[model samples]
Target: MSAYAEITYEVEDRIATVTLNRPEARNGYTIRMADELGDAMDRADRDEDVRVVILTGNGKDFSVGADLTQGGFDFDPETGPDAAWQEPAGRCSKRIFTMNKPVIAALRGAAVGGGVTITLSCDYRLASTDSRFGFVFVRRGIYPEGASAWFLPRLVGMGTALDWMISGRVFGAEEAKTAGLVHSVHEPEEVLGKARELAREIAATTSPVSVAVTRQLLYRMASAESPFPVHELDSRLIGGLGSSPDAVEGVVSFLQKRPPEFSMRVDTDQPAYLPWLNK
Candidate 1:
């Protein structure tokens, strides 16, 4: 409920919606926005009342990358010793990657540079018909950030990732869909509604702990050396969930032909073998 200068956070129907509020600036990415975003994500992850998250921007554009008015301290090598050499966008992206709840990005208008890379960590991206994505770092004489080097290739493919980032060209939502970057594109007015509908569906039907465990398993095992590790994880998770209360409800509801009333909470009821690799 706290006010954020660069973003707005609201929770309704178990879905936490984080809106980038700099409409006049086209939601220009800024250090303050990044910090606020990190805080918002942490709030969502820790709130048991929240089951899903939707991230989007205000006004015509999702984001136009960072604000150019701030000078080049972001790219300047001589800024300071305490600058930490970390891209601000990485902090927000990492938060999204580690979230227990599903994240859906509703992108409209232009999503260029950091705009595109930041959304890469989201579980799903739904864009507007007028949306355009650009990895314009190359054109700006910089390199890609937000850990896109790893996520981009995995989401699309090495070939598509290279073609997009290396070229630094702007592409439409349809091309983004063809490249596997976006799930669906809608009219500008309907994009947010579509994202919310998906979030509501997930929040209304899925088991929180199961969804959390599944997210971690896929993300962790994708780069795994072999399928054996995944198999092992699968067995462990199945063993833990088979007798859980949620599993019992899941089966009973199915046999009775009714909606499930899953009671497990992600904050406290996640499996004992969470972060499965660490186990």
Candidate 2:
């Protein structure tokens, strides 16, 4: 087990659980924490032992957003072509978006500001009944970063996105589910367990190559404005995996009435790019 003060990672049955460990601060993300998270995800992506990644927080909250007191609120626009204002959050956002394995967010408390942005990057989100969500950048007189400006509108509609981003209103779990921010809501105690179960199910059935390719295509379709070249990318992905061993196993298993044994291997050496980062 590799150790981290702000985050923890563990692998079992090809499922990797990456937990936000700053409970005393309600799991807020400091700049250091953001860096640690990116590193952890990178480790998971490179490790063949990890086929799925589950992200959750320790203690009572998922994340209260950036730690303002720890200078998480500090941002400057004049740092040059690559400004500091964009570096930290942008790096973290890219990490989540480009993660090859499926990433699930387990929310048990407030997910605000950057916290909400992190949740938005997840492939699926399961929130506890007591969880609350808010896009609080406007309240602090700052614009939403971490691709929330683009991601939120796509998840919900533009109107609802505007309402949340501009108004900075707090919404409960049901509202979040209604707005498509979360896939399901469970009891507070069940949040992590349910996330683990979902991860296990996905791990049991999904081929590593198929999951990575599908995740790449979905991210492209959602964040890319011009869909012109995406078709080519999709065709390339499908053509490459059409005759893979896992794909053959999947088909044969169905005909033979047996569970498929998928190979959890990714041939790609680099993580895919996230379009949201360009904006």
Task: List the candidates' TM-scores in order.
Answer: 0.95, 0.88
The digit string of per-residue lDDT tens for model 1 on 58-126 reads 899999998867563456556564646677888889889898999999999999988888889899999
Tell me the TM-score of model 2. Answer: 0.88
lDDT of 2 by residue, 142-221 (tens): 87888888778888899999998889999999998988889999999999899989998888877887788678778767
List the pairs of residues colliding in candidate 1. none
Worst 10 residues of 1 by lDDT: 72-81
Among these predictions, the greatest TM-score belongs to 1
Each candidate's lDDT (Cα)? Answer: 0.89, 0.81
lDDT (Cα) of model 2: 0.81
Model 2, position 207: C-alpha lDDT score: 82
